[model samples]
Target: MRLRPHHLLCTQGYSGKGYSEAFVKNMDAVVHRLRTEDKTPIELVFSTDDLCSCCPDMLDTDLCRENEKVKLFDRKTAEYFGLEEKTYIYQKLASYIRRHITPDMLADICHGCSWYPASACREKITGIK
Candidate 1:
């Protein structure tokens, strides 16, 4: 599965909501697969990925409407997690995130995301209210 760096965080925080029904359905399937198949190989990229394939914001050119903001999120996530554009086992990556990511770090990494405010991502990832 191809995913953007920040999408690792998104998958963890997913709560059956998205821009559209299609997007939600797709996200649910992807998240389920990752959860059920811990050894699933995920190739992290900086560009549009599997999750973005069905996103409403995705353009025909394969860029998102919020491309710049998305890029910033990706950069921050990669930097904070010491991640690289490479294949990783979903379980290992998820474990690393769960072990190391803090609420303050999540806030910094996801600062401009529109879904951050409304989503329970912080609580889900950091176990903090």
Candidate 2:
């Protein structure tokens, strides 16, 4: 599964809400697959990814309307996690993130995301060991 870096957090924080019904449905499926298939290989990309494929904001040119903002989020996430554009085992990556992430780090990486403020990501990430 291909995903943008910030999507690592987005997937964890997903709560059945989205820009549109199609986006929500797709997110549910993606999140479900990631949860159920721990061995799934996730390829981190800096560009629009599987989740973005269904996003309403994605234009026909495949760029998001809010591309610059999301790109910054991706960069910050990658920097914070020392992540590279490579494949990782879903379970291992998720575990690594949960084990090392702190609320302060999350706040720094996801500061401007529209979803960050309302999502349970901070609570969920902090709750994990």
Candidate 3:
């Protein structure tokens, strides 16, 4: 499964509450698969991914209705983690997130996201051990 840079953070616990039920379900399934399937190599993608595939906002095969905003988030996340699109294991991304992305940066990175207010990602990121 491929994932956007920000999704490495988003999937830690963010609930797709405001999005479609199918989108939320797909996100949950992806997260579960990432957490359990050791064989699944989750590539770090700069564009649309498995999670975005289920979103209603996806415009084309690899585009989003809010493409500009999405790109901004993706760039910010990639820059923060010093990552480029490449094949990566889920554990490696999670480890980078825990070792580098601090609480203060979390606030800035997530401030533009609508889900940040109610999403469990804040607690999940802080509680990473």
Candidate 4:
């Protein structure tokens, strides 16, 4: 969905709010658990630190008010998994939406997409069974 329009259409993006210390810890634990459970190096990103409301987890039609877990994970845990670090901000993403960058952030965003070995490729390998 994001890729289709992102590559040829729009890709403006932005950040939401700050993260809580507890949520950060929980996210770390969750990432560990998810990878272990999936038997792959997959990380379910939390786009917000403030999970005080279901807003962060739910896809409400309204604008999301959550922190970017992907950005945080890239900074906090990618190296541990032997992955490269990447960052993105709404300001730039917003511009990307407007076709600011040549390739745009859309392609870069998938660079860290954690669903490969976890969900998409789960059946191909015996790791996640």
Candidate 5:
């Protein structure tokens, strides 16, 4: 899975009503698969990949309607983690997430997201009430 930087955060299990059912299903499957497999191949890239490929809002084949919004998520994650484009193990990435990302940071990054208010991801990552 070649994922954009922002997807590193979004794939932690957030779902919004605006997404297509197919997008939701594919994302769920991808996240589950990555979590269960110890060495699933994941590369950090600037362009879209597995997750955005299924998005209903995709335009011109690969661009997302929410591309700017997604970019913010990516930027914040990269800034906090000192990320670079590289191949990584999914399990290792998950560990980095648990170790490096903080609740306040996730909250600020996701605040502008349309799904922010109802996101299970927000609750899980931040325990925010």
Candidate 6:
């Protein structure tokens, strides 16, 4: 079924209430509680800007970059895995390369986990030039 528009809480009676944080918090707690309830299983899926959550550092995105298993975890969380070789982020980077972001030298663009900072594509995002 389509999942995008489902409200975390039903707001049918209330129009004056603007963005219910209380309802959101209660809903979040309910979701966490129900997940381990054993009688019912609730599966929530979202993208990894994901692997970022598991990691303490967003500047160093290595946990997602280095281990394919963590990558697979995010995949499994989002959906059933194995639909592609490259990730959505990787593909977006590749697309950037094809367009405006020309690398000045070979070393500037890294192919694999190079053990630098968590900043995966630092130069691209920072506007260093």
Write down the lDDT that model 1 would get: 0.90
Whole-model alpha-carbon lDDT for candidate 4: 0.30
Q: Which ten-residue region of model 4 has the weakest summed lDDT?
A: 1-10
Question: Per-candidate RMSD vs. true structure?
Answer: 1.0, 1.9, 2.2, 16.0, 2.1, 18.6
lDDT against the true structure, each candidate: 0.90, 0.86, 0.80, 0.30, 0.74, 0.30
At residue 15, what lDDT does model 5 achieve?
54
Quote each prediction's TM-score: 0.95, 0.93, 0.88, 0.24, 0.85, 0.19
The residue-by-residue lDDT of candidate 3 on 1-129, one tens digit each, is: 888988888887665463898998887788777777765677888889988888999988768998887788888888888888888888767877877778778877776788777678877887732
The CA root-mean-square deviation of candidate 1, after full C-alpha superposition on the true structure, stands at 1.0
Where model 6 places Cα greater than 4 Å from the true spot, the runs are 1-31, 36-46, 49-54, 57-67, 75-129
Cα error, residue 124 of model 4, in Å, equals 22
Tell me how far the alpha carbon of residue 24 in candidate 5 is from the true structure, in angstroms, after superposition: 1.7
- Worst 10 contiguous positions by lDDT, candidate 2: 120-129
Candidate 2 structure, TM-score to reference: 0.93
Instruction: Report the lDDT tens digits of candidate 2 across residue range 17-87.
Output: 89999999999999999888859898988899999999889984438898888888899889888999899
The TM-score of predicted model 5 comes to: 0.85
Model 4 C-alpha RMSD to native = 16.0
In candidate 2, stretches whose alpha carbon ends up further than 4 angstroms from where it belongs are: 60-62
Sort by TM-score, top down from the best: 1, 2, 3, 5, 4, 6
Compared with the true structure, model 6 gives a TM-score of: 0.19
Per model, state how many residue pairs clash. Answer: 0, 0, 0, 10, 0, 4
What are the per-residue Cα lDDT tens digits for candidate 5 across 40-98? 87899866788888887777444678778777777777787788889977678767776
Please report the candidate that would top TM-score against the real structure.
1
- Candidate 1 on 34-113: residue-level lDDT in tens? 88885999998889999999999999554899888988999999998899989999788988998999999999999988
